[model samples]
Target: MQKTERLVAITVLLQARGKMTAQRLSNILGVSTRTIYRDIITLSLAHVPVSMEYGPGGGYYLPDDYHLESAIFTREEAISLILSADISGNHNLFAGDTDLHHALVKLEAVLPEEYRIDVMAAREHILVDTSAWCNKTQEPTHLETIRAAVLNSYQLDVLFSDTSCCQVHPGAGMLWRRIEPHGLVFKGLSRRHARVGRWYLVAFCQRCRSFHTLRVSDIEQVYVHEETITPRPNFDLHDYWREARKQLEKLKPPIIFKLHVKAVARYSTLHGDVTILKEEPDGSAIVQVNAESMDDAISYALGLGADATVLDPPHVRMAVAQTAQAITKIYS
Candidate 1:
């Protein structure tokens, strides 16, 4: 029996039978007393509210008010439901954050042994976050249609409006294009420092004869084809995205600068624009500011006022100092 299954079984038994001793639970579940004790600890961590009574009638029992609506699920069914909830999270159409999270926990606590390891591994690799920068929901228009097309392996006739495309096709606003929807990804430039992101469709463009990552937001219209298409062979979304980001980084690398910011301003300094490298005893931090250019970097540091100072890239520091002196002259 897997740990999760055993934990769920223990929970059910305690809730139904009431006041089960460790030895009894161990014998019933075909596990050791030591294992039962550990399982009890795990249940507590998952917030099951299991309590123990001491002395002659000593045994573990759940509070009278605590109740779990139990359902028997096949191994595959449980795994799928758990992983789906894990990936989608409380964002998107599934907006019940608290309820869905707890439901996932309960479902995961009952997965059978054969499917447990694989499910856990899959969870680590797949994540779908639909949150925008300021804790706001940033869902794209026509996201539902695009998502359905990707899942069903359908071709799409899309009206795309890209500012960059305007140079090539002057006066052309929204271009009509056909594509085979390969996958959907929600990501930003630097995965580590990316707090803000938009949904992008990784599709094989029929006109371009190449795979293009099109911003879903920029897609003005979407028409799903009646006929479904087979998925492209040997196509891996993760691998494709990795190579695409590499090429993009080569074209324009991030402009990085060092900053020494007071703790009070640290929250404002971060704001998804910087990554902290170290923290000091005086409640200050050394952070690396990432931007598109030196001007952008200088502007960010200056915005922090006296709470932040540029430490490296002497030229940048000089520029920031000059800007500050000019501002001081205006006030004086």
Candidate 2:
């Protein structure tokens, strides 16, 4: 478990149970008593409202009237969160350092008496299961290590596969990269119905002298060096990600397609843009839409079926005609 997660757990435990001895906290968190002592000290330093008591049965606890500013989730909000945590395939957000069941136990303990019932009712009532039907969720294995390296500002040695497309195959040539990792992106699976995620590491590549994004799963090895790093000047992680997405978009020139549709012209614009240029005498709409490629444009037009006709672009018209002929042949 991460130190940050452990501190949060300790704070929740102390606030919920009134007081717990360091030894007990150690037992609960699976750490040494000495580590608990250190955490208590750290919490105190961070102004977490934690205090230690000295006596036979004494331990560390928060003052009754005292609570951290962050401990302000309302009963409804808390229940919603607990409900979300209970669902399988939820992000490790609620389950970090401990399972949701245990975390909810501590959470309910801290809640006011009136809220406890709501929490319990929510636990029994609502269920959200996000696990894919066809495939199990695959958690990225190297995300933690890479995130740690980024947070600690350590130089990282990465041995990654030449291509992410066939990452499982052994024969993909190895590429050694040294980077000062800045951010991690939990991108959705590029493949259809894939439950697994593809984690991308955004880092300053020393060799390339520019920021680079690489798949974490494709990375065959990771070596975090102790030496501190100098982060690039004026490089914002969010900005970089946005710019990278734009670059990817520019790879294929978008198409502007002209169409005449009998109806559902509005729906054609959902994925891109559709502007009504004119309305035909026969109650049809003449419109223009943008698509990433000719295939996308053709597919969108096809989806409109006989209701839509390609008005311009001779090449697209030819392709659609050929496709229509093929369909007609199959039917005939």
lDDT of each: 0.72, 0.68
Whole-model lDDT, model 1: 0.72
The local lDDT score (0 to 100) that residue 132 gets in candidate 1 is 52
- Collision pairs in model 2: none
**Regions more than 4 Å wrong, model 2:** 1-71, 88-96, 99-105, 161-173, 189-196, 252-332
For each candidate in turn, the TM-score is 0.51, 0.51
Candidate 1 residue-wise lDDT, 238-319, digit = tens: 6788887676568667677899999899864455457779999998999987876666676778878889989987988998
lDDT of 2 by residue, 6-64 (tens): 77668777766678887557645656567888988888888788877898768888989
Distance from true location, Cα of 16 in model 2, Å: 11
